[model samples]
Target: MGFDPSRPDIHLGHVVGLRKLRQLQDLGHQLILIVGDWTAQIGDPSGRSATRPMLTHEEVMENAQSYLRQFFKVVDRDRAQVVYQSEWFGKFSLADVIGLTGRFTVAQFLERDDFAKRFAEHRPIAITELLYPLLQAYDSVAIQSDVEFGGTDQMFNLLVGRELQEMMGQRAQQCFLMPILVGTDGVQKMSKSLDNYVGVEEAPDDMFGKIMSLPDEFIVSYFEYLTDAPVEGQTVNPMDLKKRLAEEITEVFHDQQAAAAARDRFERVVQQRSLPDDMPVVSLSTVSGPRWSNALVSAGLVSSVSDGKRMINQGAVELFPPSGQSLKITEDGRFEAPEPGTAVKVGRRRFASFQE
Candidate 1:
């Protein structure tokens, strides 16, 4: 399979292809991985709305190294052969590139969905971007691959590989395409750039919560793509199914114990309206200027002061004073500490306690 490490990590979307490759590997097929160190500079245009920003050689290499480590989490390392585009492409002359480009036509390239849309919208399609698929097609030739695995969005690039191999007098490779997994947003495909992705390397608690946060309609799809769990034809409630889906997926990447702990934490903190047992203890003075947003930031509940402020305005922040009447952090700009024993809850999962 030809892989361009456009991003550093493997999101669940990329796992679809990796899982298939592992299945094939288990069936005694030899795996040849072609890393797109050179082609990444051009950037693959598949499923892109606008042109992708080109990567420097240094950035591409760093991403490629990170990709192989994550790639092995699903695929076996001992059975795979790794080749880089720089191996042959570096040796190719301008005449060779011109000859390679000669075999394909502009009209043929325009047939791709992303290119067609860009053309219709009169978008600026970079000339280097046009070279992406052709470069990828040449990877199949370099490796002389028997089968190439990719997402359904990569149909055009994979087909180009088959044709390019035939033109080069090599056997055409089989193109195996898998369904793309949707992100937590339940709209776009899972992508690290989109920030809706649940990464394979995420902490168990974070991964579980991210999965649970998805729209209920996406539960079955997550189960289908990320786990071997059977959910089809089951009439379970969507909420229960969602938790099952989250736990199943969380267990695959983490241990069953970790998954269970994450589920329990979610139940206690989110569903039961109870503070977490492990909630951090901080001084009331940690708020410095008594800034509620800064307090959340210091507690590591939110990414930034602005996000903390937004959470407060959205009524996601509350202080449980000793009087048992919870006071909501309605004012984002400032906050007043009620009592020494007051407990702070931010959003649905994060909690902290104020000490004297």
Candidate 2:
């Protein structure tokens, strides 16, 4: 199992492969987690239309530390061996590099979809990009991996590893590819950069809410990839199925008690249109004006006044008065102050009430 420290957090998308690693570990196979400290500098070009930005060694190391911390949440740290590729690549001499390169040709490199696309489009392919698959192949050779796990996009690189391993007189390793998890948008692949990712570290309520918000069509896939819950023969409402999926996933990251509590909280606050028992209260003593955006920021509902304003314009900002109907704040300029007991709801999971 190899992963690059390109980001600091692990999302549900990465969990698919991690779960497979866990299954293998339980079957008495040794799990080797290879942190691509060296390969990340070159950046894997697979599934990319343009060159990826390079990360400094410091940034890569920092992300690697974060990756290990979060990785242990799903994988048993005691049974896994963690290694950095720099241990071998840093010691490679010019002759070693030449020897490695001599085993492959430019024609074979260009056969890669990423390189072929660039060549056809008259795009410049970096020499380092060409070397990425080779280095990745050498990783398996260095570790003498018997089996490698990755996403479908990495099939080419995984095959390269097998080829390189056989060239070095080692038995060819088997490749296991996991399906790409769809993002929250229900369209593209799940990614943090796209802000459509549900991180494994999110609060239980947040995790529950995000899963519940997914398109009805994704319930089955979410259950199949993220949980061991059965959905084969029984027919259930999509909403109920989604709820079950959300609770199952939340329980895996959290606990059964937390997952149940989150579900109850979501039902009370969202489905029932009632306030949460533990909703945060904000003191409005120093705040002036009926500026809903500023009040939202003061309550810590939005990150900034500008974000509050954007939410307001997007019709996501709502004011629920204690005795009256909930009012949606549409316009941005000054307005009358919200009643003392009014609770502000922002997006799906955040809520806060004003106090004197």
Candidate 3:
């Protein structure tokens, strides 16, 4: 299996394949994990509207370093042989790269959905993107893989690997394509860049809350792909099923005790419309100014300053000042940081108790 370091974390979307790989390992298959350190710079063009930004080798390696612990949650670390592309690709000369590119034509790459559409609309397609599938294909050749695992979106790349392997006189590997998990938005596939992903390494309460916020329709699929527990039937309320889904999936990444606590925390803050007993605390110790945006980011309430503004403007945020009047963000109005002991509510799930 090949995973690039384009992102830092392996999310629940990836768990589907990782789980299957574990089953294979139990059947005594040697799992070779290929970390695409070199390919991350070129960026995978799958499901993209335009060319993706390249990453520095340093940045790619840093993200790759963080992948193992989350990866080991499903696949055994000791049972797997982890390899980086730099080990092989670093030794390639200009002549070698030219040779590798010669094996495929531009027409072959344009057959991909993203590439085809971009070409029809006269959008820019980078030469590096055309090389992405081939580099990924070479990984299979280098590792001599017998079976490859990837998401359905990667069908084109996986097929290229099989073809590349056969051209090198090796047996063509079987491609195992898994379903792509939909994001919490319910419209798009789960991706880290979209901010709709429920990261496996997120806090129990946070993970539980994101799952709860999913559309009712996604409840059943989440159960089928993410957890072993079975959902009862359509007779049950969808909201209730979503909660059960949240608890079951949460229990896999965390203990039942933590999952239960998170469920209770969700109910208290969202259903009951009250502050969580253990609401996260935002320390005012190092804050440079009385910027509300700074507080939101520091407490992990919002992702960034722009996100904080969006939530506030959407009326999803409220500040319960010590004076008992709720303060709201207003254009051309004072939106200073809350006083110490202020309680901030961002949407229904996130709460921050600002403290000096």
Choose the strongest candidate by lDDT. 2
lDDT comparing candidate 1 with the true structure = 0.86
With a 3 Å backbone cut-off (N, CA, C), the pairs that clash in candidate 3 are: none
Put down candidate 2 lDDT per residue, 1-356, tens digits, no spaces: 88889888899999988988888888999999999998887788988878888998888999999999888888889999999999999899999999999999999989888889989999888888888999999999999999999899999999999999999999999999899999988999999888899999999999999989899888888888888878854577787888888899999999999999999999988899888877788777755447878878778898888998999999998888888998898877774566787888898789988766
* Ranking 1 against 3 by lDDT, winner: 3
Candidate closer to the true structure by lDDT (higher is better), 2 or 3: 2
After superposition, candidate 3 runs with Cα above 4 Å error: 280-300, 303-305, 320-332, 335-342, 354-356
Residue pairs of candidate 2 with colliding backbone atoms: none
Instruction: Quote the lDDT for 162 in model 1.
Output: 96
lDDT of 3 by residue, 107-138 (tens): 98899999999999999999898989999999
How much does each candidate deviate from the true structure in C-alpha RMSD?
Answer: 2.0, 2.0, 2.6
TM-score, model 2 to reference: 0.94
| lDDT (CA) per prediction | 0.86, 0.89, 0.87
Candidate 2 worst ten-residue window by lDDT: 283-292
- Candidate 1 per-residue lDDT over residues 1-356, each given as its tens digit: 87888788888888878888888899999998889999888888888878878889999999999999988888899999999999999999999989999999999999988999999999988988889899999999988888988889999999999999999999999998899888899898888888899898898888889999899887877777777778856678888888888898888788999999999998887888777777778876666645778878876778899998899889999889866888888887656665887788877767788887
Show the colliding residue pairs in model 1.
none
- Backbone clash count, each prediction separately: 0, 0, 0
Off by over 4 Å in 2: 232-234, 286-291
